[model samples]
Target: MKTNQFLFGLKNLDRGQTMKVAIFANDDMTSNIIFAQLFNMSDIQITGLYIAASPRKGTSSIIGGAISLLRRMAFGYWLFLVFTNGAFKVYEFLTLVFRCSPQTGTFYSLRRAAQLRGVRYRKVADFSSPEIAAELQNSNVDLLIIRVGDILQPKILDIPHYGTWCVHSSLLPSFKGIAGEFHALRTKRAPIGSTVFEVTPSLDEGTPLGQVAIQRDETGSVFQHMVNNNIAAGKLLASMVLQAFQCSAPSFELYTPQSQLKSSYHSWPKPDELKVLHRQRKALITPGEAMRLMLAAFRWG
Candidate 1:
């Protein structure tokens, strides 16, 4: 059986009938990678980008933040995230600084992507603000993609004619939270991949438009696996958007009650899970793998 079925038939759209798309994206490498893929698409017109800025930390000290993460994620998993995430940040920073080209395959900022593609980009503090809604209305955005952003309200979601969509890292209606890939790996889930789904008020419970299987290298570092997933997700989402536009009228197949009941949420890994990961001999990220990725990024640029 196929993993996903297109609910609408495909057809060609003329230049004048191009779909106007907007993105609610984050500043991180994952979001930027996804943006790069979408920016390269000539069929859809990218109208605007609403950058989801990181929330302020106020007066919280580094130690306080570390302690809070430790309480929830445990020391082992927390340290793993810090080290790997710090490495990713450094990688992203160097790519933006050195790369003069707007090519794909490297980590770059969303701002950089916008500047290269000549798309309108703005940092969004409050998504529910009337001003934001007005901007979307003025832009005549037909599709709104939530690559990275907070939970959206119905008012904003309803503005897009094709409705709001989200790209989840997992094949949802299953593994519905953060660390979705991690949990899928631990449980040996079959057909691990990404899903482009309709964004509803219920998180990760929306009807899926399509899914593409992404095979992971379990023997490799978690950091590398995550980066690979992000790249695959970007391509999958771009393909989804293209397919949606090709159809005369796009729609999705809702999940049955049994599938809805199977939706499970996973949080950050605990100490026990970390132990199991180690038992599998999967390092968070080896120094060699990090260097290789950086070199690849440089070459791609």
Candidate 2:
């Protein structure tokens, strides 16, 4: 059933007539690369890019030598984004060259919708944002695709023409929540995948757009899951999102009603719960950070 839904989405793509779309994803690196790939595959142009972790004014004070080092690292990353981002935007521009159903405009104010190609960034929280709506009201957005990391409100969900969607990092209805890797480790599961679907008011419980299973392990770390899931699912979602922008989203495989009976969103395991956790020596910590994170976690015998 799952495979059939995916094939159906592809068939819809093989027949899609228009392709104007936008993307949202939390992992900056994955969003960047996936957009690059989408540029290569379709005539769809990303209107603007918004991250889940929307950047607000904040200070990171790493005094002394660490300041210069951090700045250099940031500068290098920014440079990389510039070159790559420039290329992806070029794809957007070229793709939209012969088309105009998706209105295109550039401005700096509350009277225009924020754009992926635009300098300003927004998140699901921005739907309540008067400034964003004011600026974006006149500009038409056909579809909005989310990648990961941000939870959205219904206000944002109501903005886009076809509504909002995202690609999650786990197989839905099975392992859902804050950290699925640790969840997987505790459950001793071997594989996982990304589920692209509509965003509802529940936790990872939305009807799926699509999903692709992935491989994982007992000795794995968080970053490993992050990179793997995005890479595997990123390209497919990009392609499908473009298709969805052009028409009705094809329904994919859904969780069984029995599986849907699973209840209670679980929190990340606490220090006191280690007695029930699977033990592994894989270093998920640096001596200093581990000590700091667990400072209040240990007690004297």
Q: Which stretches of candidate 1 lie over 4 Å from their true place?
A: 1-15, 55-71, 75-99, 189-191, 248-262, 293-301
- What is the TM-score of each predicted model, taking all chains together? 0.79, 0.56
lDDT by residue (169-283, candidate 1, tens digit) is 7777677777666666666533355677878877677777766556767676666666777787887777668767777354332233334335677877887987777888877
**1-301: candidate 2 lDDT, tens digit per residue:** 3432332333334354454455655423345443444544445645555544332213222122223333433343333333333333443344345332222221011112233334344543343356544434444555666665445556666666655676665666566664444454455443466667677766577776676766765555443554466566766676566445444445444434434333334444444333334255432323543233233112100
Q: In model 2, which runs have C-alpha deviations exceeding 4 angstroms?
A: 2-18, 27-36, 39-41, 52-127, 147-151, 218-220, 245-264, 272-278, 282-301
True lDDT of residue 118, candidate 2: 45
TM-score of 1: 0.79
Measured by TM-score, the strongest candidate is 1
Q: Cα lDDT of all candidates, in order?
A: 0.67, 0.47
Evaluate model 1: give its lDDT. Answer: 0.67
Worst 10 residues of 2 by lDDT: 102-111
